[model samples]
Target chain A: MADSPIVGYADALFSVAEAEGNLSAVEDELFGFAQTFQANEELRSTLADASVPVARRLQLIEDLLDGKASATTASLISMVVSAGRANDLPAIVDAFVDRSAGSRNKAVATVRSAIDLTGEQRQRLTEAIKTSTGKEVEVKVVIDPSVLGGAITEIGDDIIDGSVRRRLNQLRESFR
Target chain B: MVASLVSLMSIVAFAGPASASGESVGSCVAEKFEESLHHHGESDHVTSDDIHHVAHDEAVQDELEACLEAPSPILPELTEIIWGGAAFLILLVIMVKKGFPAVKGAMDARSEKIRADLDAAEQAKTDAQTVQSDYEAQLADAKTESARIIEEARVTADQLRTDLSAQAEASIAEMREKAAADVEAQKAQAIADLRAEVSGIALGAAERVVQSSLDADAQARLIDAYIDEVTGSNG
Candidate 1:
């Protein structure tokens, strides 16, 4: 697998999951790996550097995941890095997520927040989104410090922004 | 003295006639002759024969004297006048022939020389003017050539400067374009990273929603509804 072989690997992974009857679990794990890769700049740079040995990069992935991920998920990540596809980790994960969502008949809704939401808040927000858009959503949230307060969500091409960052930007623009 | 002797001879001839008529012929002859002699002595020796001779010589002597002393009828004074006039006429002819021709020739030669000198001067002046004009023309040509060369140099310098400025501007524009491309690539990489991070959070959030919001039966029903929605929309 090449450095930018995201789609190819994603297709292979999706097929493998379909064959093994564990698409959801693999998709979820891949999604979490993508998040960890994005948030950690040092990990991304290390994995992407061609000078680092393939064995060392694979070991780094194993050590990082340890007991947090399934055997299948760890093996899959290791295989990708060993093949020098570390830079494509996020794209592969996104593809896997999309594939899994498609198989289960659902839309991927990416959401961001300054803090983790309670159970009631998630339920009400999901119901509200479902009622407003008339579509089944698989909601995912990212805790971002840059959000400051409030939440912003995206479903496919649609966006729902209700955040302190956006309010402050508007205020700054008005002052200018 | 000649005239007194002639007068004495005339008296004796007269006295001889008187005495001859009065005496015998012989005695008369002797006495008359003696008397003539005495009278001649008294008259400065005048002889009777000398008186006859005087009377006979008178006409011939007068004729001879006339021939000797008539003042030379062909006048030498007239000959001298004629000779002097002829000499003066010859001198005048010689002077006219020699002096006048020489003077005329000298004047003619002088006038010819003057005319030739003037002609030579005119020719020299014309040659000098020609030479001066030629020099002036060459000078003008040189000035024009210098001006042309200066103009060409100025044009060449301006072209070089323009070319240099254009090259510099082109280089700056190329550098700016490369910088912009690099920036765009970096921006794209950053956005992709942000998107991936947010997707992970969304996954975790979804899991939490599943775990907290619904029991087994509700989950099954929610799953069924999602499946129905997706299939209906896609179909």
Candidate 2:
């Protein structure tokens, strides 16, 4: 993972977010934007398309992250997009989150839910993950409606799934 | 009998006077008899009875002498007998010289002809018998050939029947195997299709149920429940 070009981009984004003195907020905003970019095929295609003008792609990134992300997060995403690395945006953001979590001496955990979790729930989930892993963990929650209900937490290679969608899939497999 | 003798004697007396120039023996004998009878009549001057008896005796003696001098009535002339014997001998010699040989030659030729005809007929019979024997042998050979051909045909027919039976059996076996495999395949495919359809229906119904009951409170409850479950399990 560290040998990938995504690591270099993540490092560049990490350096810029750390220098801006808001690494955690930029990392969280970038992670949310990366999820949106992963889910939106049109946005990813537009950003990665070579025939599109670089200025236009940068403008589109600016427009999507306008008021929602900090200037450092927007600028880092715009730099990656302008560099024709939009298709690798999710990987770059994930690497950036991993680096940020590593600096705090914590493992990164990606959590998926059908609905937005309350602050208390996120805190409880982070503590639950840290207890389950026996290590400090930074939890990143992605609102994925396909989760249907409950949540699925991915910590390193481990997955703790408590999803209605997973239950339905298991039921479908049993029928076969 | 006496009249025929006298007619025969008269015929002889007339034939003798015709042949010699002299008086016939029968007339001479009658003159003598008459002379004697006149003498006797003369001598008998004593009685008439004695003279008649003497005349009859003299007449019988003169007739007897005349018969003695006549030729024998049953005997042929010597020259006629000799000539008849000569003629018979000549005819017998001619028959022996020419007719016997001719008759014998004709009989011998007829016998030879008969014998030659018999030989030709015997040869013809032998040839006919030989031809019949050859025909019988040929017929026997033909029968054997016919039997051999019939046997060969029977064997060929048997082999062909056996081969056809085997082929038919093989074909039937292959068809049966293929049919069994097809049935198994169809059965398996049907089972798979049923499983897929039932799974799809059950899954669709479960999704609907889950979607219907999932309100905001339920979602929060599920999240809290997941955190509690994970923390409890880990703890």
Best by lDDT: 2
Runs in model 2 deviating more than 4 A are: A1-3, B1-171
lDDT of model 2 at position B83: 48
> TM-scores of all models?
0.43, 0.60
lDDT of 1 by residue, A10-51 (tens): 888888877877777777777878888999999999998889
Could you give candidate 2's per-residue lDDT for residues B1-235 as a string of tens digits?
A: 3334544554554464345434567777667655666666675354556446654685657664864575657765565455446555655676677768888999999999999999999999999999999999999999999999999999999999999999999999999999999999999999989999988988888788888899999999999999998898778
lDDT of 1 at B166: 100
**What C-alpha RMSD does candidate 1 show over the true interface residues after superposing them?**
14.0
Estimate the TM-score for candidate 2: 0.60
Q: What local lDDT score does residue A154 receive in model 1, on the 0 to 100 scale?
A: 77
Every candidate's fraction of true contacts kept comes to 0.00, 0.87
On the 0 to 100 scale, the lDDT of residue B60 in model 2 is 56
Which candidate has the highest DockQ of all? 2
Q: Roughly what TM-score does model 1 have, to 2 decimal places?
A: 0.43
